[model samples]
Target: MKNYLIALLAVVTFGLASCGGGDDKAADNQEATQAVEQKADEAQQQTQEADNQANDNANQEENQEAANDQAAAGGKDGKTLFMENGCVACHKETEKSVGPSLKEITAKYGEDKAKLIEFMKGNAEAIVDPAQFATMKPNLEITKKMNDADLGALADYIMSIK
Candidate 1:
């Protein structure tokens, strides 16, 4: 009877140890699952950030393209810029006011757009009315700062007047 009791107690102890091991395994598995979930969440957040940055870059590129298109449309933008930049205050389409008229300018410069552009840059002599060039010198401060597209547009609008 004594030996039988000892054998039974040993079996019970072994059984309890095995059951506790199973619970430990379950806890380990739960921790592993939580770790994997955290990693997945981090990856998802990174992907979303990358997507947002790409969209912002694409939008900026689109805005730049639209600006380029508008600048290239010289007829509209050029005429508008010309009037807004105070060219209308000195120059006119027909009659000469503070400077030579557009007709006089076109007749003098003719098809030589190079000379016209050069005059704006303050590099060439004024053939339209050399005597009145001193009065126009102050205006070059404004024209010299203009980009080529704007200057071309301004010239186009002026030439179109005739």
Candidate 2:
């Protein structure tokens, strides 16, 4: 009877020790999982930062290109002035929109750049589409504010369209 009791006690003690060891292993596994998650989060943050940096670089390149184009145009290119002055909203190269097409204006002017400049300066009447003069009247106010050089550039760009 004594021997049997000793053997049972030994078995119980061994089982308890094994259970304690399992809890430690479980804790170690949980710590490893948390570490992996932390590493993954760090990697994701780095990737996001890289994407932001790439976007910033692209924006800088675009700004540089725009500056270079402006310089190439001698401070103000005719086409740039035209686009900036809202001419593109109405006068496309070939197709008409709210007003006459640039091609139509070019055909009417026929290298008469001075007349075109005069008209933009509001010194001359609308020869291409006199019917829509009222629609363009408000825009003339904007052009009337520009200097002769800018007006000439705008007229040159309009006349150059095929």
Candidate 3:
């Protein structure tokens, strides 16, 4: 009977020790979970801030484009006014058309700003694509009938075709 009691006591002691060790492991797991959650939260916050900055930059770019368009409509540069008024309708960029293409025109003038502006003022003959000049001749009559300010704007736009 004494041997039986000793064996029972040993079993109970071992069980208690095992339970104590398991408690410490549970605490460690809880702490590790808390750390992971905290790091995830920080990452989420950083991502949100980056997204907000991108949105702000996009908005600023859009605003800038709008401002440039408005300036193109009213600038004293003349070419900007012509582009704003849709003078590109009859003119093409490289090939021939109802109006001479800008590429050929620029090729003939070779970037002479003063001469181009003067030519746009209806003073000079068409340099590169005279074949289309006849078609545009009636347009000159119509443009001449326009107000001086409007005509200047159109001429400026013509000079900018390049």
In candidate 3, what are the lDDT values of residues 1-162, reduced to their tens digit? Answer: 999999999999999999999999999999999999999999999999999999878855654564455467664434544455455677776766766677666667774756655555667787666776776666555555555555544443444444
Clashes in each model (backbone N, CA, C under 3 Å)?
A: 0, 0, 2
**Whole-model Cα lDDT of every candidate shown, in order:** 0.81, 0.84, 0.65
Q: Which candidate is the best by TM-score?
A: 2
- In the predicted model 2, the residue pairs found to clash are none
lDDT of 2 by residue, 17-90 (tens): 99999999999999999999999999999999999999878965765565466567677857888788887898
Q: Write the per-residue lDDT of candidate 1 for residues 67-101, one digit (tens) a residue.
A: 46767764345568778888889888899998888
**Model 2 bad stretches (over 4 Å):** 1-74
Every model's TM-score: 0.53, 0.54, 0.43
Global Cα lDDT for candidate 2: 0.84
